[model samples]
Target: MTSQNKSVPAFGYEIIRDYALSTILGKHADDVLYWVGKDIARKFPCSDIQLIISFFEDAGWGTLSIEKEMKDGYIFQLTSDPDLLNIKNRKFRMEAGFIAEQIQCFKGCLTECYDEKKEKQSVVQFTVKWDTKEKIG
Candidate 1:
């Protein structure tokens, strides 16, 4: 599989970044996190670093630091990690496993889902993670 255009962010890249921030800090990212102190703050919400890391570990994406969060645009590299990039154009079953895993971890949310195809007379089901920073505190 190839394409004429390249350099596109994956399906949920921005969402994951936002989720990382909101979940860790209990606040919306008015700007993308980029600096070391800003990054540190993301990990240490009101100075609780351990809990933030624990949250990431529990979520199963492993420990995610700020890496680099661009204010104007996405830090494309940081926003789209290798694992996520690896999954594009993969099998449905594989995608489901990742999605299910993320949902089970509680680092994200499950929104509504509907299947586009019904070829086998079966209903395929899925849940989408929440993609925004909100007041969860």
Candidate 2:
């Protein structure tokens, strides 16, 4: 069998990983060489980058990529439907932010919540920062 059939196609951990990483790269659509903390994050009890991407893809998060750097961490990006920005429950944001803070240099996540009026769909975002080493990493 080919490598494609050698493993499970999806897992929850991957979903979490993809979500966190993607949130980082989502900071700037034009930013390059995006890097994020993987080592410490790897132990978070869920999926890794690729699997996470798959999970998000299943949930309709669109395509994703992980740009890497050995010492600086990794960069995870996701391109998805603009209208589906759901942080409907503020609790989710709190939980995600808390998770990010626990990682190594948790660079925080940027969420583009669309503002309803203005003739165009404009998104407003927030960044929450922390150091994983200083917390649970």
Candidate 3:
């Protein structure tokens, strides 16, 4: 996917994404955010991978790229500014859920996504796997 040059203020974004949501949601923040991501995906669906990547950039999430393609899944890498990565107790579950639902909608299958934070690399890796047998109707 092509990259976009647009940017958003990290400070304000984090205040809502990391601080406010986490403070209000507390222990359930991750789970709630994941579902919220899915809901957002439903509200704004992307039919192709490029559109999905563009959506991420437009949402000020980060730059998303495909790291690898598997038979039934895909691995995506998300990267942003170093300062964003350095934030304490940051979470990417919302992005993960958005990916899962987006792929499910695109492929018409049951899909799931999980994210792994690589602090050393300052990146988040998302794994999206779909069950071909379980078609979504």
TM-scores for all predictions: 0.20, 0.32, 0.89
lDDT of 1 by residue, 39-130 (tens): 44344343232454354444333333332333211111111244553323221232233332333234333222111222232222332334
14-49: candidate 3 lDDT, tens digit per residue: 788878999999999989989998999999999999
CA-lDDT, candidates in order: 0.33, 0.35, 0.89
TM-score of predicted structure 2: 0.32
lDDT string, candidate 2, 25-98, tens digits: 46542222121223223344233445545644554434444534334244343444443433231112322332
lDDT of model number 3: 0.89
How much RMSD separates candidate 1 from the native structure?
17.8
After superposing candidate 2, which stretches have Cα over 4 Å from the reference? 1-45, 80-132, 135-137
TM-score: which candidate is best?
3
Q: On lDDT, who's better, 1 or 3?
A: 3
lDDT, candidate 1, equals 0.33
